[model samples]
Target chain A: MDEPPRSAPMSASVPPGGGPGRIDRRAIVDGFPLFVPAVPFGFVVGVAVVESEMPAVVGWSTSLTIFAGASQLATVTLAGVATLWAVAVAALVVNSRHVMYSAALAPTFRHQPTWFRWVAPFFLIDQVFALVALRPDGSPASFRRYYLTLGVFFYLMWLAAVSLGMVVGPAIPTGWRLDVAPAVMFTGMVVISLTRSPAVVAAVVAAAVAFLAAGLPDRLGILVGAGAGVLAGAVAEARLVNDRAITDEQEFTP
Target chain B: MNMSTAFVLTIVIALGTYLLRAVPALLLADRELPVPVQRALRNVGPAVLAALVVVSVASTADGGIEVEVAEVAALVAAGVVAWWRRNLIWSLLAGMAALWVTLVLV
Candidate 1:
């Protein structure tokens, strides 16, 4: 199958006095909005670590070092079974999306110097990918620079927020209901994902299957739900492609 | 589960999590994916995010599969803000404010 056309122009045509190949400052500015949501959610993850009876250092270090909110939350909240094996399994399940993010953006960076290409994946996150995909103008060179800057900015924000959350976790009242933070973040992601119809069907089916299977032990609902969702989405996407191909062939016939 | 032991476990967890995140990208970076694998990767983001949303909303230990009104309301409010404004800050603020109010009033 052909790749989807690049959503944005590859470059901003330079006017008489404009510099060539400069990164867009507006895209970076646009990314600031993402951090506002991320910080409170980070704080909530901090609260989860404390409430789950894990040490503050685990919460802080995991947030800083691991740097993915969902997996960190799953690790701490499920700390009853929180063996090294379980945590590794949960982290693998949650972050497997990054492989997709990296692959989607790989072609854009195929021509970049090898070092930059290697370093770039370290900063790839959902928010960074969304912003890069939405940028209106950039050459491959400019896009690479823009994406790297955006990634670093968000990465630093994540570190700072997690650090602040760790320090402030004790002071926040116990009954403050920080659990909503994860829900908010997850809802935002879901809403963004729902932009496509196949994704919506996948999400609904996955949630239904997960609810039905919630009786399974050892947090296996997550694994089952995620697996079912991916299976459903892949099937739906394949069907959609096949339908479109048939339509194109019919249109080409005399 | 003592403090020092907890700290050690946390360090282990942190290392485990990082290795999981980093290793796949490292291992798969050089390999060209098959068409089916590429298609599967494309669907992974939405599928994973969707599963996360379900788990987040429905996994409370309330002894039944009841929707937490406050959580659901907060999520809907947040979803609306995100859709309408596409601004993460505004969406979060709206969601948090709704949740806080629901918590207070209910």
Candidate 2:
């Protein structure tokens, strides 16, 4: 809540199995702000399922099986009107960004145990990635605890939020306008990501492209915007390196 | 949708998503990526988050872009609070507060 726990707590606690490791309290608390957006987003997904006239049990199963909120919304909405393959493709594309998250964390995951590697990817959603991707290097034990704690907490919370939605979604008025909640929460994420110049450039370009390409079908616009932003940020990073080299040259020549 | 159709869709989507997340994570471990690729990957989070924010804010149900002033105000309020306080709770509270106030006033 008050700036992410900057330093990992040094004291290691005994695990239930008698192994010793640090249990990160920050991981538990860090998800508080993220849940703000997740609650409304999950509710909207539940409402979509209800509105589409899908069976309640089937709708709830997607939450358990699919587990990702945005893709769950897409799958639930499309399953009613679109073909099965079409719905599958949409869900795949919508959730494909996790590939990037996986790539970014590969090095960190490399040092982790084989079982951890196999299972940890299940929790690689956007909020989890956003929190862990920027984390300072810490012990593998601590990282595992941090990742799993946050992961499980969010997973349960998501299920609860969606279930609550399924129960009450139909009664909620459309005029309540919970639509903008995710945007507000994501804007907070964007703010946190502005710590670097390349990231700033990337965010600006991605926002512009995504705004313009909002008409693209199957959420391809987000991918396009993300690609363009990454390229722009890479170029910016190269230029920064060049400028720094030039500065060093100038200083040394004097 | 029918129960069978729903189950099939869920299973298909679940497998596809898991592979997308797991394959690269498993295969790319311990591999030293090219410098440029690493640099680009580092920016992926910001790029994706920014894209998500725009799409979520602007995209309508019919896949059209619509900018609501109230929503923009809320985003600005959240961004500012997040920047100033460096805390997510305050930012969320500020943004929600701004949104409700603007919904009434505007």
Candidate 3:
């Protein structure tokens, strides 16, 4: 795969739908990259559910049914009084990015059927979205189909890992080892995040803020850090773009 | 909460989570966002992920701020793996290995 150019213009021409020949291959090819990360993360989440004193079935069902890893982790980790509300809020916040992901791909997917449209969103995880969005010439239908293929594969992997972890929960030694899971997951997220322009500064600033505010109650520090990072990145982008516009205008002046 | 209550809570939480994950895609299905707003949304994932990582590493035993060398080592290893390969599995493996080594040695 070639390294994508920094800011290539999106293709206005709509490519033919993957039909049967290309869509299946595209899905499998794109989906394979996601499986590796999902397994470890799923295992960790499974372990977390057991640690929370919840039944192993709950973990398995949650992973199998919901299939949203970050939200699942946040929900189980903070499982306490009014935990339902907290999980709801956190999941909403975390998944808010999907809207952007879907919107980015909408132009390509404008031709897909409503049924396909409705079902495609459920599988719109970060990896699926990234793969589809990065495609050189994928149409909306192709993107949706590709995402569903990835989603199905991911869902299966997640279910298997969670089940394995839940079944073997007692045998897995407890301690610092479990901590490695989140660290690893978060690290991958951070790296992917860093590839984009403005996120580097945002991540650094948010890390600093989170470190300072780590004492806040009920994991509010995470919220604060996230909010700060978004605000920082938005401000930076706004300023940079504004400055560039001014420079361009000045250059164009008579 | 009691076992039954916790079970109910878990169910509620699970449902709530699904709703959140689904809502954004559902709402923005066919809608087109302004360029500026779209750009802002683009940064959300990275920002949120970074915040999560910061909190995870900085979070202390008593819920206070404290930096542990092991955690720092893990973070660095993870960052290196991610930057070098851009592969999630390798990055995670590197971080986990770093954490395990640090834990055993320290």
> Which candidate ranks first by lDDT, i.e. highest?
2
> Which one is best on TM-score?
2
Off by more than 4 A, model 1: A1-27, A44-64, A70-113, A124-126, A129-139, A174-176, A213-220, A246-254, B1-15, B27-32, B61-66, B84-87
lDDT scores for all predictions?
0.63, 0.80, 0.62
Candidate 2: docking tier? medium
Candidate 3's residue-wise lDDT over A79-109, tens digit each?
6634566655764554444444555445445
Model 3 has an lDDT value of 0.62
By DockQ thresholds, what CAPRI class is model 1?
acceptable
| Prediction 3 TM-score vs. true | 0.73
Q: Retained native contacts per candidate, as fractions? A: 0.40, 0.79, 0.47
Ranking by DockQ: 2, 3, 1
Task: In angstroms, give how far residue A5 of model 3 lies from its true place.
Answer: 18
Give the alpha carbon lDDT tens digit for every residue of B7-72 in model 1. Answer: 665566556555544455555655665555555555555555555666656765542444678887
How far residue B1's Cα lies from its native spot in candidate 3, in Å, is 9.5
- Best-performing candidate as measured by DockQ: 2
Reference-based lDDT, residue A203, model 3: 72
Ranking by TM-score: 2, 3, 1
Give the runs in model 3 whose Cα sits over 4 Å from its true position: A1-34, A37-41, A47-59, A70-113, A124-137, A175-178, A246-254, B1-11, B60-62
Docking class of 3: acceptable
